[model samples]
Target: MNKNKKVIEVKNLKKYFNVGPGLTLKAVDDLNFYIYEGETLGLVGESGCGKSTTGRTMIRLYDATAGEVLFEGKDVHKMSRAEHKDFTRHAQMIFQDPYASLNPRMTVGDIIGEGIDIHRIMGGKERMERIYNLLETVGLNREHASRFPHEFSGGQRQRIGIARALAIEPKFIVCDEPISALDVSIQAQVVNLLIELQRDMKLTYLFIAHDLSMVKHISDRVAVMYLGTMVELASSTELYDKPLHPYTQALLSAIPIPDPNIERSRQRVLLEGDVPSPINPSAGCRFKGRCRYAKDVCHQQMPELREVGPDHFVACHIV
Candidate 1:
């Protein structure tokens, strides 16, 4: 554990949306987590679990309804305009869909150099040189930067997005499912590239992905969320070896084993009920409906994330 290397600290973070006149959507409900310098923290959950919202809100894409996001021991939301501008240079995001994220009308070079232009970091020739260098770093050539986004493959387009993020010389990046839209074979290539970049540039990442196998491979610590609430968090090996929460156990059970004998021997745990809606969620455990061990206490009181073991936390009545 890197005790002295805290880069981003999130405490009791909440992001609520007004769905209607009186109703509210609890996208990220009282979440608390942290990211260390030069480390990859993986946030994993099913669809609509608020993993993406948490990442976006931390970077101030959506104004957080409550809680503090501290970057380098300073409150990120409370920064001055000049400080915020500097923050933008140090922090960046890679969107889920590379095609939708990039501008269709702009050439790849322009898209990559947009941040440099906005920040006034370089002249015309210098900016073009940086763009070409960024493209090369992301496995794309300088010539490819002359074409529009439509001219590239999904993986190649994602490379362009990565180049754009790198153009600003960011120290931290929010990888919002950057490879979800790519081919399975290409997924590994992208992950490898990210790993290489981290090694070379000492970049820190908050890698949000629903793919458990891939998350385990890339993350230093793993956090599990359910219906806008975090249920479990721990080191990758610890989470996989001994998942404390009922939801975490069920999720791990569903991962298929390659060996025929092991696969046949392992029993699959299938939950009975569907995930409850985030909007106007019941005042209790959000995962109560699908938890086999859920009791009356689970329906009456929400579980706070508590330390179960060394660096392992879980939110469940049984835990």
Candidate 2:
């Protein structure tokens, strides 16, 4: 991997929602990360931990409340109309729910060709031919192009989503839990397809998921998030083998081992207490409430992500 080539750089990116008159939800709080070109950077966290929100905010689907998202050194939220349209063509997203993402009223061909039409890439026979090729590229036939999203199965619909994202030939894609809604049997197939496509197209991806085991298989580097803060980040193998943060250790311990003997002998690290609310969160280490090794310092200051060993980073005062 080329360390100097950065496709997306997120510096203190934050997204908050005004829930009510006085209430605000801190969905993503001061997130900082980078996605290198031709690499799949996995963002793994529990539900409601701002994984999807981060992805949406990165692509400018939602306006960030604070900080900046730099797509190849350009401010994503401050782009001109033409520049924003160009960014859309370069960066695309595949949503989590295949059933809800695709338009039921539109046929498969129209859905895939939507970006092509908006970009004025082609017209007439050329557009039709492009759609047909995309259909076949995603393991679908030409005949399936005429059918609506309602007719396809969950896996087929996800394949359609993939085709649609690829239609404009995007260099970057935010895969927001793309296989979460699919059947367990078909999840591997979809993941394998993405892997093959990434290899062939030299695509850069920010793959978000809650499943740590799955992330280990597909990601070159993994970032572990809790509540709305990142706890640990490192290469997939290193993070699993030597996690520095207490939250990271607990999350890794939850993943069931394939070997029966090892699984039976291994001790599970279970976290206590409920996750604290993100709305106007108090100043302190977010994991201190559930962490077993919390100290007085942890409850007083919010630890910034610090480099401990090589590329591994941890946000824990005790560590």
The number of the candidate with the highest lDDT is 2
Q: What clash pairs does model 1 have? A: none
Weakest ten-residue segment in model 2 by summed lDDT? 274-283
Candidate 2 Cα errors over 4 Å, as ranges: none
Q: How many residue pairs clash in each candidate?
A: 0, 0
Q: Against the correct fold, how does model 2 do in TM-score?
A: 0.98
TM-score (all chains, Cα) for each model:
0.97, 0.98
Off by over 4 Å in 1: none
Per-model lDDT: 0.92, 0.92
Model 2 vs truth, CA RMSD: 0.9
Error of 1 at 17 (Å): 0.5
